[model samples]
Target: MSAIPVKSKIPADQQLKISPFKEVIKPTVPHKHANYYELILLEQGGGYHQIDDHQYDVSPPTAYFLKPGQTHCWNFSCIPIGFVILFREELLTRECLDIVYHLPTTISLSNSPSLFELAKQFCQDYRIPASQGVLNTYLQLILLKMNEEMATPAPGHQLFSPVYYQFKALVNEHFLKIKKIQVYAKMLHLPPAQLTSICKTASGKTPGMLLNERIVLEAKTLLSNTHLSIKEITDALDFSDASNFVKFFKLYTNLTPGQYRELAFSRQQ
Candidate 1:
């Protein structure tokens, strides 16, 4: 398969950029962003946005989170007024950006006024002649504010310590290859029992539960967002075979992988 074309509107010489929504009267080409993250805060507009294979309506007081390598495109009746924050992983590590990374690609924010106000401040700071440190502080504050709102209990947020955060970071990298909690525990230099205890104590869930959830989540993401077949996604997710993967996925989701994908596409239609 051909690789998805990726691009960033950010200029060179800056690892982080804040872009104001200029009037976009034309349809955009489908593309992805390599090795970076994007947060788009929309204040007012009505249109459609395609992120990966999922189509989302573009409504005001909403936000979108695009992780590195997510294919997306947009069309609008008129340009939305808002700001888009783009930064590379080097600017914010996987562990540091846990809050942003876990958020869904599209969300109708509950608190848009405060977020828009912060965006305005960030825009002002970008143009002012100030110390880079001060400018970075503003950037961090904007993300922190977003994180605060995202921590609401509706989604059952976990307050991550260093160890748990590191564990999750490692899982994000190795879950496709290493599904066993014992292996992850060994990699973290902790016994399997100890890892389970840590996970249970911190999040009221076992290490296996966390690992399996991540695996299932990734499988669902691929199934919902790509045209890969069952055998293909099975191989991509490191399952033993398509049958094994089907049973495992059905065990958790109560739906066959094909059923899940069809339902997802049906919703899109």
Candidate 2:
């Protein structure tokens, strides 16, 4: 099993990259970026996109968001015309992070010409080597526009809370080592039960469930994409031993780690 390639599409010296989308002439293998977020805006396209566990159709006037460490691949039946925007965490402000945390992985941009124009402008200005400040402003506006299109009500208008988003960010950063709900609650300065309630209300999942899901997703990615042995993966994931890792994985996926790897490889063939 060859390791799944980790790609860095953005140049080393740049914190952001904006370019027009070009048709993929060959099948894209599953790969991930260790840092940065990718926003793809398509004016028109065909086929489907695989992001982690979700597969979304290549609909015209659609946007796809890929976060750091998430595996993704594209299989386009026809040429795709759009722009791909890549930005590192340095480029995100608190407000922008709020918007990004809430944006769905896939967004329908139909009836949203402003977004397309903004993306086009972003691509063009990127070539001019626009000032970082100007580029940051454009990125913020694009995110704000997408948030508006989501039609999410104001903070008070909805049952949502920024704490939930904060919790999610924390989990994304620490899920590999911290698995306790109480620890997360302590970090958030909320009681364990209150944190559970907030998570359930906001996303229909308990904090523990979310943590487990993240662990499971990472395990699957490693199993499917890398040649690491079971014991190696267990150690990397901080499991006590290979047997315990297999048991935990089976509980969530109903398949042992090796079996899951075989299934994943079969699908590729």
Error of 1 at 214 (Å): 2.0
Instruction: Report the error of model 2 at residue 205, Å.
Output: 3.8
On a 0 to 100 scale, what is the lDDT of residue 48 in model 2?
A: 82
Pick by TM-score: which candidate is best?
2
| Backbone clash numbers for all candidates listed | 0, 0
**What CA root-mean-square deviation does each model show from the true structure?**
4.6, 3.4
- lDDT of each residue in 11-60, candidate 1, tens digit only: 66677777687766687766777656788989988789887656888887
lDDT of 2 at 227: 80
lDDT of each: 0.74, 0.84
**Which one wins on lDDT?**
2
Off by over 4 Å in 2: 1-3, 11-15, 89-95, 151-163, 180-201, 227-229, 266-269
Residue-level lDDT of model 2, residues 197-241, one tens digit each, is: 999998899999998988899899888767899988898889999
Single out the weakest 10-residue window by summed lDDT for candidate 2.
151-160
